[model samples]
Target: MFSPTGEIVADAQRRGVGVGAFNVITVEHAEAIVTGAEAAGVAVILQISENAVRFHDGRLAPIAAAARCVAELSSVPVGLHLDHVESDELFDQAAANGFGSAMYDASKRDYEGNVAATAAAAQRGHAQGLWIESELGEVGGKDGAHAPGVRTDPGEAAAYVAATGVDALAVAVGSSHAMTTRDARLDHALIEQLREATPVPLVLHGSSGVGDDDLRKAVAAGIVKINIGTALNIAFTGAIRRELAVQTSVDPRRYLRPARDEMAATVTRALRVVTLL
Candidate 1:
């Protein structure tokens, strides 16, 4: 059965486990994510971001459809989500195009505006039977906007979740977005505090920068969803590069298949680390 985002994520939280949110850049990525999840017998989230939609000419249907198809066929639970969507139109597009969940990122907006917009988006998403996740405090590392010093306040997080009625909250603890290295450290104390403050499951964005030991501790501290992108993308692209380098005249499938297989191996390993499997 296809479990809703809130249900699967909440269950994972209760079990002291974390679910992987893998960014789907192509149909191949989606396939690898779902395939790994089914093999592991764990629920997974397939995410498409605003940038991904733009890559497809503002239409999210193709990727969204592919994710939904994977979700439907997978033996394990899978949820299609829109990640870091900054516009109402993109949010609406994700909802309309078959995404079961979405994260409305207004983190760049002023605090009050972020609250209002995210709250409105939460209402809109819930009305469509979609789960909504919102971020607080910016995840740094994109163009150097975030540093290890960034953190979210427990009081503010509680208020944001209350005001927005979101299904989950993505809080900045210490990870930065788009980090090519794995030196980021999480604030385990902050994780415990935020977990105590908020009723909803907490999400950790920019997780690719977090080390495996730190990721396990974060989940142990109560983070239910961990979003990893850059790490897996690097693994996938590296495999493609390796295959193409050895056989320059090979078809795309010849290269892409190895990429997908390598990515699935990475996903499976990370899932074990994050979920304590």
Candidate 2:
């Protein structure tokens, strides 16, 4: 059934499990994420990033519609989220298009600016009954720009949530974005501290760089929402590359079918691991 993002996230928090939020770049990605979630019998978040919206020339309706349709049809609970969006217009567009939640990212701005912008966006999002997420600045490798030394302050994270009224907060412990290797070291103690410090559910961005064992530890330490993009993309593109090498067929379905299945398998594994299913 189609679930509200807040409900899904709240359930994860209650169950002490991590909810996997997968980035959807295509219809196939949406289908795979939903199929994988159903297979795992766990609720999942289908995320549409700002860059992904730009990839479709700033038109999010088609992609959002596709994701909503997938969520509606899925046997397991599914929710749609807009991730790492820097603009209010994009957030509004997503909410108008039926996104159950959104992350308003103004992390590049000064602290006060980030708080002000995120607060406004959160207010607007809340008005539409959308769950809101935001991140602290320098949360490690935003858009492939890595500052591994950067870490979010638990006190500041608590303050940010109080000021912004967001439903979730994505913090940096050690992981960086777009990492092909799962070797990022996380601060387990710090994660526990953040969990105690913040009232809202905690989100872990750049989770693709975190290894399986580390991911489990992070969840145990209190990460509720885990955002994964690069790893799934890797699985999908690798499958496509292999399929094309074996067949001369120019049909996109011939290649995309296997790619979708491969991604589904990857998602299923991640869901099982994150949810401890």
Q: What's each prediction's TM-score?
A: 0.97, 0.97
In model 2, the runs with Cα more than 4 Å from the true position are 142-145
Report backbone clashes per prediction.
Answer: 1, 0
lDDT of 1 by residue, 122-174 (tens): 98888898899999987888757565545788999999999989989999899
lDDT of each: 0.88, 0.90
Least accurate stretch of 10 residues (summed lDDT) in model 2? 141-150
Tens-digit per-residue lDDT, 24-53, candidate 2: 999999999998888898999999999999
Worst 10 residues of 1 by lDDT: 142-151
Largest lDDT belongs to which candidate? 2
Question: How far off is model 1, as Cα RMSD?
Answer: 1.2
Predicted structure 1, TM vs. truth: 0.97
RMSD of each: 1.2, 1.2
> What value does the lDDT take at residue 40 in candidate 1?
80
